[model samples]
Target chain A: MIIPYLELAISFLRVSLSAYGGGIAAISLIRHEVVVIRGWLSVEEFIRVVTLAEMTPGPLIVNTATFIGFRLAGVPGSLVATTAVLSPALLLLTALMLAARRLESRGQFRVRIQDAVKPAVLALMLMAIISFGRNAVTNLSTALIAALALAVLLVSRRKVHPVLVVIAGGIAGLFLL
Target chain B: MFVVFFRTGLLTFGGGYSILPVLHYELVDSRRWLSEQNYTDIVSKATAIPGAVSVNTAFLCGRVLRGKKGSATAVLGMAIPSVTTMILIAAYLFEYVHHPGVQRFMKGAAAAVAAQITYGVWLYARSAVRSVWVVLATAPLFAGAFFLGLHPLLLVATALVVGGPFVYRKAKLKAATSSPESEYSELME
Candidate 1:
């Protein structure tokens, strides 16, 4: 039990440390680890996991860590993984805040980095879309469902919460699609 | 303050960019924890970082409010509610999620997720591609990631290293001529 718990700690630690761009972009890294490498979840299970993460409210990555950890070693494992995943960011951000205090004059430096990295982050998100789309859009029906969801989200401009959009898609799948 | 972040965590429906409106409403509008500009600063910086955007925002906000202790408190407040709920949800999901109807519904949910991500692509692209050069340069990047199937980390690094200077030059040039005030605004807050 302890062994699996520790393993969950380490695995999620690595994932949280490595994942960038957050949200769906981080899902790719989690998929590569949990689904592809460890075989902890199969492809279909992975899709379900992503869907579950989307449907529920919280940080997607943290929710994923908790879910995977629970699957590995129950409640304790979930706690361990959550802590492990969060610790790095806590430590890094604290240290960065400390360091950044002294280098207060370097204001423009950070802006340049932000300007530089924005497009790359955008590209990463694009990759996530393509990869997930390939897996989810298996048939014309699924494709139409995807298209409808996209149109709603785009047209709404976030006026509609995504959870509703997801539920609508599920209903469409059940009845119309 | 802790309550504010806790509420933000609990209220954020879809995470990532979803947290923005809640933050805008609570911290910016209601409590006035920070000005709109300061809030945007925290958000953009949080987005640029490698971790969860909501967590990052909480950390930065906490830091600005008090210090390390505040940061820790805010992070815990933001994470705990969602973590507790997720454990229950995960346990429930593991049980009957194997049902055929449930599976089909989830499949549809997955397709919606793909659509949701595609929408995110449009939103991010609209914000990030500010100029013709950016559009030109990032097109190949889109191709490389979508077609050639390069690792995301590799692409991110290559873009940062290769595309950084191009955009920076453009931004600097525009800042010098057009809007000198806004150029350094990102870091000042």
Candidate 2:
């Protein structure tokens, strides 16, 4: 049991470190690892975890970790998995902060790094959009709602808050879906 | 104040776009901590980082509002609700979310989320993809990832290695063009 718990922690650590475009991107990877590779969870179990993670709070990645941990090893496992997943990020953030002042002082290096990073980041976003979109948009009503939402967003120039859009969409979904 | 944002964070489903409107209302319209321009700037910066833009925005906003104490408060607020909820759900209804009705609703919500994501991509492209060169570069990059089944991280890594030199040269050119004389002139003005 302890060994299984340790494996779960390490597996979550790998997922955390590899997740590039944040939580949504991480979900696919987590699903693949836990459901497909490790056999720790089934596909249905994976989706349930994801749904719970989405409906809950904090980072989705952390929520997923907690859920997976609890599922495998109870309360203690949840704590271990969450800590393991966050540790890498905490350490990386600390290292970055320590070097931040020095890095900022070097304008050329800073600009170069930004230049390299920006496009890559954009690419990641594009990937996330495409992948998640395929999974999310399935039916006609949904497709239309998504189209309406997109139009509202584009035309409004982000004048509206995303929360309202989500609420409106939810309400629309309740009626339309 | 922190608790308010925390609750908002927990309530937010979907992603950054889903939460953006609420955040704008709370931070700008209601709280009046910063102007619209400031909020937009922070969002841009948050997008550049490798995390949830909402979480990053919360951290930045908190820090701006109250320094380290504010930052701590903000993160705690944002984290607590979701952490608690997920844990409870994990413990109890671990098997309950998969009902057909629930899945149907999630599917519907996901569609709305898809649109939101598209809007985000369009918005970011408008600001970031200025030149034909950028478009030319971005289009095929997206196509390769989407169609070729290429992993996104690998694509990002490849882009960094390949685009680094040209981007470096461009930065150097821009820096050279904006000389010390202009910098001093602007400073004096």
Off by over 4 Å in 2: A1-5, A97-100, A106-109, B1-5, B16-74, B94-104, B179-189
Quote model 1's TM-score.
0.73
Q: After aligning candidate 1 to the native by TM-score, how far in Å is the CA of A173 from where it should be?
A: 2.5
- Cα misplacement distance, residue A26 of candidate 1 (Å): 5.4
Residue by residue across A1-177, what tens digits does model 2's lDDT show?
579788988888888677656678778888877988899998976887777777554567768888888878887888787767655654454354457547646663333443454565566677767767776776788888788877776677656765566556766776777
The runs of at least 3 residues in candidate 1 whose Cα sits more than 4 Å from the true structure, single-residue gaps closed, are A1-4, A21-60, A93-110, B1-78, B89-93, B166-189
RMSD of each: 4.7, 4.1
Q: What is the C-alpha local distance difference test score of candidate 2?
A: 0.67
Top candidate on lDDT is 1
Mind giving the per-residue lDDT tens digits that candidate 1 earns over A1-177?
A: 467777777778888777665666678788888887788889888887776776566778878887888878888888888888777876776675567565545533433444565655666666656656787789988999989988887787556765567678877787644
| lDDT tens digits by residue: candidate 2, B38-77 | 5654554454454455666676677667866886677667
lDDT of 1 by residue, B98-183 (tens): 67687677677767767765665564465556688666666787788778876656766777799777756765566566554775
Clashing pairs in 2: A57-B82, A161-B21, A162-B21
Candidate 1 chain B lowest-lDDT run of ten: B12-21
